[model samples]
Target chain A: MIRGWLSSRTDLPLKGDAASRFLPWVVAVMVYLAVLALAGALLARDSVLRWSRSLTGTLTVQIAVPAGERNLDVAMADRIDRTLELLRRTPGIDRAQALSADQISALLEPWLGGGAIVDELPLPALIDVALVPGARVDLKALAERLAAAVPGAALDDHGKWLKDLIRLALAAQAAAGLILLLVTGCAVAAVVFAVRTSLAIHRDVVEILHLVGARDRYIASQFQRHALALSLKGGLSGWLLALITLGGAAWALLSLDAALMPRPSLAWLEWLLILLPPFAATGIAVLTARLAVHNVLGRMI
Target chain B: MSYAGGPEIVSDLTFQLAAGSFHFLTGPSGAGKSSLLKILYLALRPSRGIVELFGRDVRTLGRADLPALRRRIGVVFQDFRLIPHLSALDNVALPLRIAGAKEAQVREHVSELLRWVGLGEQMNALPATLSGGQQQRISIARAVIGRPALLLADEPTGNVDDAIAVRLLYLFEELNKMGTTVLIASHNESLVQRFPHARLHLEGGRLERRTA
Candidate 1:
C-alpha cells in the first residue's frame, strides 16, 4: 500500500520536452566516444599483460658464421649443434630448439622478401629458448659459456625490448583513459545544459509546486528522472553502435589474419567492460541533473 | 515584508486571527494586501518581523521545514496558477499528490472536489481550454483539496460572475465552518460586504482591523 502510494505520488508530466530530441543524440555521441576509448584502454592493457606473461621467461640465442668462410655450411652446422647441446645441459633452460635454414628464411620472408637472396645471405643461426617457470637464469654467465664454445654467439634475454614494449602499451592505455575522462566530462556538460534548459522552460511549474508545498527534493527528482531516461536512451544507443563497430573491426581483423598488425581479440572479462560506459553515462546524467536543479532551487524562495 | 534596499511593502502588521476564523483583506492598488498574504502563506519572508504560523516561529524556520508548514496551508494566487499542460483534475490533485497520498484516495477526493466546483464535465480539460472563471474555480479546488488548516486566496473571485462569486464565498464559509482559517485579499469590497466576516483594511502598507 505504502509503495503504491509513494510511487504514484509525484510524477512530472513528460510533455513540453523542449530539448529531448537534441539532448539524447548529443549524449549518444558522447557515450559512443567514451565506450570506444574505454575499449581501447582495456584492450591495450590486456595485450600488454598477455604479451609480458608469455615473454617473461624466454631467451633467443643467435650464432653467426663468418661470411667468407671456407666451408660456411659445415661451420654453421657445427656451431648450432654445439650451442644447442650447451643450452640443453644448462640448469635453468627448460627447452631449446635450433631454427632450420628453411625456418630462418621463412622468419625473414616478411622483412627481407622471400627469394634466393634470403638463402644466400649469411644470416645468424637462431635458437629459441624457454626457461622453467620461476627459474632464474644468469644470462651473462650463460652468454660467456656460449661464447667460449662458439665465437660470435649472442644471447638476448629480451628484457630491454620487453620493457620498451610494455611502456608503449601503458602510454597508449593512459591516452585512452584521458579520452574517456574527456568524454565523461562532455557528457556531464551536456546533461547540465539540458537540465538547465528544462528547468527554465518549467520555471512556472516549479514556482507553482513550491507554492503548493512541494519540497525541493520532490521537484528535483522529476528532473532527475527525465535526465536519467534520456541518458539511458542515449547510452544504450551508443553502446550498441560501439558493439557493432567493434564486431565489424574484429571480423575485418580475422579476415586479414596476421597480415600486418596483430589479430584483434578480446577476452571474456574485457568484453564485459564494454558495458560500463552506458551505465556510467546514465549515472552522470542523474547526478548532474540533481545538482543543477538544486542549484536553481537554492536561489528561489 | 519588503525587497532588499526598497521601501517596505507591508509594515506595522500586527494582528492575529483565531483558528478557524474568516477575514477579508481590503486595500487599494499598491497598498500591499497581496504582500501581507504572501508573508502569511510563507511565500515571502519578511525582512524585519517575526512571523508565527500554526504556533511556530517562521522567522527561524529552516528551508527543510517550510514544505511541511506549507502543506498545512494553501494559497490561491491572484492569477489562477493552474498548470496549463495538466487537466483540471490533475491540477486539483496536485496538493494531495505532493503530500504523497494514495492514488485511489487522491482520485476520489479530487474528482469529488472538481465536481463540487461545477467542473465535472470539464475535469479532463486543460486550463488553457477553460474559461477564466473555470480556471479560477480549478485553482480554488486545488487550494482546498487537501483540507488545509489555513487557506489564503488573493482576488479569487475577480473573474467570476456575481452568482458564482456568491457560491465561491459560500464554499469558503463552509471550509471555515469546518475549521480552516480563511484570509482573502480582494478589491471587491461590495461583494465582500455581502458576507458577515471580519475585515483587515490596509493603506500605504499599514493594517487596521474591523470586526463584525
Candidate 2:
C-alpha cells in the first residue's frame, strides 16, 4: 500500500499542478509569521513585567523630631544608621544601603537634567537593597518596622508600575494567541482547496483507477504523501526566512536610544513559541489533504 | 454478463468456446454483434443472460476481481486501442507490468512476441508513428503477450488492406492453435469467408447458431 502510493506520487505529475506547490509556500509563510507574532507576545511581555518589578526591591528609613530642622538632621542620619543595622539582621536581607545626597541626585539626573537648579530641593532619603538572588522580601512587615524606627520613613515596592506593565503584557500576549488561531485556520482551508483542485484536474486518472478497481485508500495515500512533503518544505524554509526578517526587526528595536526609551530585551527561552507555525502547518496540510482526497473521491466516483 | 437496464442488448445468450476454439461473430452494424462480443470480453454486461467464463459469472464478478480476468482475455478494439504515449513495445508490455510479473521475464516474453508479430523493427516506435496495419499488429501483440486464455478482436481486419488483414488473421489462427480461445467480430463478409471458423450470428440482440 505504501509503495503504490509512493510510486503514484513520483510517477504522477501531481507537483505539476501549480496549486500543490504554491499552497505549501503560503502555508509555510503564514505559519512562520504567526509563530513570530506569538513569540513577540510571550518574550516581550515577560521581559516587561520582569524589568518593571525589579526597580524597587528595598526599604528606606528617616527620623523627624522637634528642634531646628538642621539640628534634627543628625538625628535623621542616626535613625538611618539604625535601620540599616536592623535590616542586616533580617533573614533574607542580602545587603542594604542608605544613599548619600549625591547618589540620590545621580539616580534622578536623566529625568531632572544636570545643574539646572539651586541646592536644597527637598528629596526623600533612599535606601538601595540588593536582594539575595532568588529570594522574596517581605515588604509589608519591613514597612511597618521602618515607620516605627523612623517616623517619616516609607517603603516603596514599585507596585503600581509593575501592575500596569504586567496587565499590558498579558493583554498583548492574549491578542497574539487569537491571531495565531485565525492564521492556522486560514492555512488549513487553503491547503484543502488546493488538494481538491488538483484532484479535479486529474479526474481522468481517478476514473482510470476506478475502472481498474483501485481501492479508495490507495488513491488517497498518493495525495497525502505529496501534500505532506510540500507543506513541510515550505514550512521549514518560511520559518528561516521569517526569523531572518524578525531578527532584523529586533535589531532595529534594540538600536533605539536606551536613555530616551526602554524596551524589553529579547530572551532565548521565550523564542520557543516561534516553532508553533511549522508544526501547525504540517498538521494542517496532512489533514487538509486527507479530507480533500476523500471528499473528491466520494464525489468523483 | 447480466445487465438490468430497461432494454436488453443481448438476450438469453448461452454459449461457450472451448480452449483453443476459434469463433467468428457475423452480423450487420448495430445488430448487437459488438455488444455480444463486449459481453464475451467482459466489457459490457448482458441485460438478460448468464456469461460464465473460467467457471465464474461475469455479472457476479467484483471490480477487484476483474483485472486478472481482463488480463487473461485480451481485447483488440475495432479502432485499434493503443495507448499513444507508449512505444509499441511498452504498449505490448503494459499487461505484464501491471500484473507485477518479473520485469526480466516480461521483457523476454514481450520482445519475442513483438518479433513474431513482425513489429521487431518497430519496437522503439510510438503507437502514433505506426501505420494502421503496424498499429493493429502491435495491438495483437499486446493482446497475446500474456498468452491470454481467451482473445477477443473486433473488426480485426477492417482497417488494413487484404494482404495485411490476411497476415493479422494468420496470427490469430496461430494463437488459437496454441490453445487460446479466439473470437473475431467482423462485418467484412469476404474476410470471414476466407478465414473458416464457427460462426455465431446476432440480429436485434438475438443470437443464432449457423451449424454450417
Candidate 3:
C-alpha cells in the first residue's frame, strides 16, 4: 500500500514546472547546512563531556619556587614533598605523586620546544593528586592547610579551566542549534514559494480536478508527494555531501597532534543523529506544501 | 452572481434538476451557461441565492463537506480540461482514485470506459498528443466514469462530429436511465431540438423552463 501510494500519478504537471525542478536543489543545500550544524553541536557536546569526565576525581598541586631561583631549590623541593604528603593523608585523596623534572619537560614540549632553554627557565614543582570516587574535598581548606604546612604551596583542582571549557562548549552548541533552526526556516519558506508558484502555474488543471470530484486533500496530496520526492532527493544528496565533507575534515585533522586537537569522532548514536536532517528536511517540505495547498484551496468556491 | 465586484453574469436563476432526469441548458455565448454549470459543480458560489445539491443547501455546506458532495457530481468543461500531463487512462481514473477506490478496480473500470469511448488504443496517450475531438471524448469519459449522481457538461460535444455528439448524448442518457441526473449546456439549438429532454434556456441571465 505504501509503495502504491508513493508511486501514484500526479494530475498536475508539477514535475515539468521550473519551481519543482529547483526545489530539490534548494532542499539539498538546506539539509547540507543543517547536517553540518547539527554535527557540530553533537561533536562539541561529546568532546566536552569526554574532557569533563576525564577531569573528574582528579586534582593538581603547584609549588612555586622563589622568584630569583632559577630551578627547584632545596626549599622548593621540601615544599613540594610536604604538599604531596599532606594530599596523600587527606581523607578524600587516594594518591598523590610529585612530577619528575623529565615529566614536566615532556608536558611543556609542545609549547616550549625541546632542550636546555625549558630546563633553564624558572620552573615550579608539581604534584598530581587523585581523589576517591564520589569524594567531596574542601579544596579551600586543603589549600590553606598546605600553605600553612609548606610556604609557597597551592592546591589546584582545575575547576576554573573546566568551567570555562564547559561554557565555551555550551555556547558552541547553542550557536549550532540556532543555525539549524534558521536552515529549517529557510527550507520551509522555499517549499511554500515553490508550491504557491506551482499552484499558480497549474490553476486550470487544479480547477479541472476539483470539478471532477477531487477534494482539496486529494489535490494537496499530489503536491505533497512531489515535494516529498524532491526533498528526499535533495536531502540525501546533501547528507551524502556533508558526510564526505566531514570525512575530509577528519582526515585533515588526523595529521594534527592528538594532544593539540580534539579528535573529531562520532559514536554510532551520533552518526544516527547525523542521518536525521535529510528525513527532517523531507518532512518539512511535505508539510509546508500540504499546508500551502490547503490554505489556497480553502479560499476557492 | 458577480465576479470581483463586477456586474452579475448570472442572477435570480432558480432551477432544480430531478434525480434520474436529463436536461439541455441552451443559451447564447454571453447567456451564462458556463457560469451556471460552474455553480452546479461547486466551483463558484452564487453571490446571493440558495444553491442546493443532493437535497442540501450549498450555502450551509462547509469547505470540508464539498469534496464528498463533489465526488457525487462530475463535470466536463467546454475547453476539454484534461490534465495535460496525464494519459487518457489516468485522467479518466482520477475521480475513482480520488474517492479511494482500489487501484485494480479503478484500472479495470477506467480501461473499459476508454474502450467504450473509442480510445482503447490511446489509453497511454497524453492529452497534448490527442486531437481536439479525441480529447473531448477523454474528457467525457473522465466525467461519467465515476457513475456520479449528477453530471454537468458544458459544450461537451463542441469539438466532435454529429455522430459522435449523438453517441455522447446517448451515453449521458444511458447514465440518466441508471438514476444519474445530467445537465448538458450548449448553444447548439438543432441538437437541443433533437433531444426529447426538457430544456432550460438562459437569456440575459434569466431562465425559461421548457417542457419536453
Candidate 4:
C-alpha cells in the first residue's frame, strides 16, 4: 500500500509552476524564525527556573557605613555582630555569616579592579543568610526586628530584585510567543498565496483533470503532496540552520564568566521541543495547500 | 447557457443521449458545439433548463457528486489539453490513476491502450514533443482508458488526416460496441456523412436530429 501511494503521480504539474518554485525557501525562512523564537522562549523559561531555584531560600543583610566614616568603625562592627546574633536566634534561620571585607573586595574585583582604592572605599558590610528548606519566615517582621537591633541595618529578602528579573524573563517569553504566532500566521499566508498562484497557473490542467473524473480531493492531494515535499525539504534545512545558530550562540556564551551570566542551555527534551517548528511548518503547508485547492475547485465546475 | 450576463450561447434546447448510443455533434463555428459538450461533461451548468445525465439531474447534484458523474463521462477537448509536462503514457493513465487503480494495473492498461492508439513508442515523450494528431490520439486514449459510460469529444478528428480520422472513428465505434455511448462534435460534413450513426446538428443554438 505504501509503495503504491508513493508511486502515484501528481496530475497537476505542480512542480513545474514558477509560482511555487520559491515555496520551499519561504517555508525555510519561516521555520527558521519560528525555531529561534521558540528557543528564546525556552531559554527564558529555563533562566527563570534556574534563578528561582538558586535564590528561593536565601537572604542578604546589609549594614550601611555612617557618612564620613571611610572604614568599618567599631560601632558598625558591633551592629553587624548584633544582627548576626539576632538572625541566629530566629527559628527558621539555617545559617548566618558576615562576609569578610576581603571577600567583598574580591566580589567587586571584576568591576573595581584589584587596587588599594577598593580597601579605602567605605563599603557596607553584607551578611549572607540561608533559611531552612520550606521555611515560612515573615519578611516584614524580620526587617522590623533587624531595624530595631541595628540602627543602620536592613534585611534583604531579594524579593523585589527576583520579581523584577522574573517580570523581565516573562516579558521575553511573551514576546517570543507573539513572534512565533506571527511567524505561523505568515507561513500560512505564504502557503495560501503560493497555492493560489499555482492553481491559477495550472488552471487548464486542473480543468482537464476535473473532466477526467478527478475529485476535488484527488486534485487537492496533488497540491498537498507537492507542498508536503517542499515543506519537508525547507523544514530540514531550517532546522539544521537553527541548530548551527544555537550551537554558535551557546559556544559564544561559554566564553563569558559563569558568575556573570546564566548559561543558555537546553536539555535533551528541550532540543526535541525545538524540532517541532519544522514539522509544524510542514503540517501548515500541507493543510493550507489542501484547503486552498478545495476552495478554488469549489468555485469551478 | 448565458456567460456572465452575455447572450445565451445555447438556449431552449433539450436532448437526451440514450445509453450505448453513438452520435456526431455537427455544427459550424460559433454554433455553440463546445458549449453543448461542456454541459454534457458537467463542465458548465445551463442558465435555465434541466440537464439529466446517467439518471441524475445535473442541477440537483452537489459539488461532491460531480466527480463520480464525471468519472462515468470522459471528454476529449478541442485544444487537446494535454499536461505539457507529463509523458504520453502518464497522460493516458490519468483517468485510471484518478480512479485509484493500482500502479501495476495502471501501467499495464495504459501501455496497452497507448499501443492501440499507435503511440506505443512515444509513451515516454512529452505532449510538446508530439505532433497534433499524436496529441489528439493521446487525448482520446486518456478519455477511453477507464471505459467511461459516456464519451464526449469536441473536434476529436479536426487535427488528423481523412484516413486517420476514419480510423479514429472506427476506434470510437469499437468503444461503442462495448456498451460505451460516444458523442463526437465536429464541423467536417464529409466525415459525418461517412458514418451511419445519428447526427446532432446544431445551428445558432438549436439542435436538429437526423436518425440513421
Best by lDDT: 4
Task: For model 1, state the Cα shift of residue A137 in Å.
Answer: 1.1
lDDT to native, each model: 0.86, 0.73, 0.88, 0.89
Candidate 2 overall lDDT versus native:
0.73
Model 4, position A20, has a per-residue lDDT of 82
In terms of DockQ, which candidate is strongest?
4
Identify the runs in model 2 with alpha carbons over 4 angstroms from their true place.
A1-21, A24-28, A31-188, A209-237, A257-291, A298-301, B1-97, B100-158, B161-202, B207-212
iRMS of each prediction: 1.4, 4.5, 1.2, 0.9
Mark the 10 consecutive residues where model 1 chain A has the least summed lDDT.
A2-11
For residues A235-291, write the lDDT of model 1, one tens digit per residue.
999989988998887788778635335557777877777887888888888898899
TM-score of each: 0.95, 0.66, 0.94, 0.95
Off by over 4 Å in 1: A1-15, A112-117
The residue ranges of model 3 lying beyond 4 angstroms of the native Cα positions read A1-5, A68-72
Q: Order the candidates by lDDT, highest first.
A: 4, 3, 1, 2
Q: Least accurate stretch of 10 residues (summed lDDT) in model 1 chain B?
A: B4-13
Docking class of 2: incorrect
Per-residue C-alpha lDDT of model 2 across residues A1-301, encoded as one tens digit per residue: 7456434413235766886768767877787778677767876576775576656554344333434576657766776787777778777878888888787677667677556451356666677766676678787888788777666767666677677877877888888887788888788888887888887777765654443334556667667788777777888888888888777877886786445344545456665557657877887788778887877776542
